[model samples]
Target: MSLIAWSLPKKTQLPAVSLLGNLFVLWFAPYAFVAMSISACLVYLISHAKSQKGHWVLLGVGYCISQFLLLRFLQEHSVDLGLGGSFSVLGVAYFTCRDVHYLVESYKGNVRKNIVTFWYYQSFLPVMIAGPINRYHEFEREIQRRSLDFDQISKGIERIIYGYAKVTVLGNYLIEHKIQSYLTQLPNQESILHSWLVSLADWAYLYAQFSGWSDVAIGFSLCIGIKVSENFNRPLSSKSLVDFWKRWHISLSSWCKDYVFTPALLITRNLFIAISLSMVTMGLWHESSLYYIFWGIYHAIGITLCRLYMKQDNEIVEYLRQRFWWSSFTRALTIFYLINASVFIGLFYDGLY
Candidate 1:
């Protein structure tokens, strides 16, 4: 009698482990997990229906409308679905964006015939929460060359450590100290310096929390031999609000530029209308609320003005640019605008006013 032994390939091991991690994440967040599974299945089914042109696009739009309405219903009823009263779908926002990308590309006959690969690409746990949204073409290419070199592993580990430090140390410290609460009370105290301090703290805290999460996600994907796109790139140091957007949440911005902005511009043949459509879609994608619409409009105005300024051919503007303090002044102004505009992100129903 003989006992049989089985072993997995070196390259297959990371994805297998990742699948286990995905299972654990699902176990922890059952509601979000179920929602994700259903969405994945829907995309999978729709992918096979080549005869029906643009069906997946219709599905994507329908899903967005449904999610928006669900959010509104939940808000109106004061209901907590899951995960701190947010949408029960953990990565629905990211998931939908990916689905749209896949569908559009597939519709153009760019995708391959690999269901398992597509499944892993969609439900990969690292980016299931917040995303540096991955594209199927790049993901598939990476999967083919997956390896665990010492250098890659070390870089991945370093990213994870740095990201963990940012989130657990700096971000938590700011929150524990009640940065927002302090900002709220500064008006009553009438302390201008205190208000500035709290505002700066809030800004730093937001960057740490978001960029930290992105780092961790990208690091994990790297460990698994996939290089997810970078989400943040020293956005705080941006010279202009328009430059800030180009460096911040880069994957989402790229997606908007490629899928939404380009096509909208082509159809409308107007810069302002295209910018409005792209910005509003991006804003609403974050959360379904009138506040987000306003936030989108606010940024649209800022970006448009920046573009206009850059396009202007004025001697006064040229002279100002030559001044030693000009760049510093512009940077300072950009940061001030960012903080003021970002306050709208926290506003909801009553807070909207």
Candidate 2:
């Protein structure tokens, strides 16, 4: 930690503080949630939440209920009926719902895509924190016929090392300077400048913090008999919001697009209502905060605008691509910008409630 900070000039080291602060947060945030999750797990064992997806659902619902009870005993109220605990419950529930819906869609036929067992799925430890959020089908084929070449091994290890460095080293600054008591002293209503800075740090923190874990998970899975999906691509290298979505936190975005956006759109051609409702639903899923709700609408509005505007010109993306300088520049800035916005959205993650 000191070595990397020493490499940078003195002034640049402030972010280092925020990174470190976030590291501590990451380290300690899960104890309460994990205990609740385990209790949920036991309930699942005793009850009949039999399928892998079913286990996730039961676990999620039970965990939330358990958390509610605990908080209530402490004389605290839930932020919503479902929040003030790990966000993973929502994620697990969503995946379970997706799995069940998929099975129903397939009419109980050959719906077996990912053959990896539930034990392999949930028991994998890395994803329990932040997530790449893999789908069940992603593992279906690979688990059945998995192999790693020499190149794969080398690359995987590199990814893991890089990821750890990102979280521990890069994320250190964000945690130390930002996530700790420093930011809490600031007013909630921040200026555009502070918001923007927070935005950048937030993204950097998430990247180093999350992708770092993801890389470790993916690499470890590669080492073991199990394998998992990649969560991020060169997301910061996206040219536009659409491209950014395509690259960043792919599993969550794709799941949202598939289950939320498409279904909402198909239900009606009313773009405004459909998109707004979808974003609101997405918001509620995360932590049921007004901030997240607004955050959802904000992105949905921006994305919808991008989609509408893009359709206006036949040569927009193609033209941008040919103008290599513009494309690359935009992509780079955008990656930072989107993550920055993400951080602002994540403001609520600071345990405000």
Candidate 3:
């Protein structure tokens, strides 16, 4: 797909290429294509609505209903739908977010209403499945400025190779096969050490898997002369939960911050409520289950505590901040907090005694 896009002479042909590629990919799952098309049309119409406030409410309700139905279907059927198991439910989670972003930005008068550009943004093959959730404006700008550059193509190829290595070698072989297998074989599976090990391995595998897909998406976009936002940045090295969110799944976090947190904060005028709503929304976006809700709440509590701690004016805090080892200590503490939180949740879901 990237090669085909790169070979096109006219920049105007880019969206067409994307459409073709998207159609081909969606051919096996026509329902997804139809659903996404309807969503795109609705967003377009809502963008041009007379009352911005009413349209915004409608968009919110529609988004929630659609997501709920999609998730319910996914959970009930566990349908692969096609794409050779590369994605389930045909990337509805991702493209739906993109559509909402467009609708919101359109409401804010930031995006121009062009169906072609909006469709292109929704179905762009590179970031279609696993996304950095490229914004419409950024994508349009890239489309306008794109050109076939050899250097960019070479770097893109390198990134793709690195991404596949992370997915297959690090995520699949080393972590899932070797480390997880060894951990599972331990004599005491319920031991603290075993749980922690399992959690750590799970976290590592998730990062490699997600970041690897992001890398591939970004690489493919680069190959087609478009640069997308990055999704991860050494999240495990973060010194606090707040810092970790800033570094982890950056696009989604920022989206939630902008769309969910800010709006909830303004409407409710409460910090805890806003943060909890945002985090829970993000968690539910991953999977609509009790486990994810608790996961979100756990992070919300961590973030709230971090914020409160930052508001303190104590000498001990100042002294710790000045220490050279403080950063390392906090980094380790943050990672430990996250791993154990996951372990706890896993145990709870698995019926802890």
The model with the greatest TM-score is 3
Candidate 1 has its poorest 10 consecutive residues by lDDT at: 1-10
Sort the predicted structures by TM-score, highest score first: 3, 1, 2
Better of 1 and 3 by lDDT: 3
Maximum-lDDT candidate: 3
Candidate 3 per-residue lDDT over residues 48-154, each given as its tens digit = 77776865746664874476467556645776656453333567777777877877787778988677777778778888878698888888999888887899988
Every model's TM-score: 0.85, 0.63, 0.92
Q: Model 1 off-target regions past 4 Å?
A: 1-8, 68-87, 175-198, 342-353
- Clash pairs for candidate 1: none
Scored by lDDT, model 1 comes in at 0.74
Where does model 3 exceed 4 Å of error? 50-53, 64-68, 74-88, 350-353
Per-residue lDDT tens digits of candidate 1, residues 35-113? 5666667766676675746855677657755754574456557677555634445666787788778877777788886
Candidate 3 TM-score, C-alpha based: 0.92
lDDT of 2: 0.56
**Candidate 3 minimal-lDDT segment of 10 residues:** 80-89
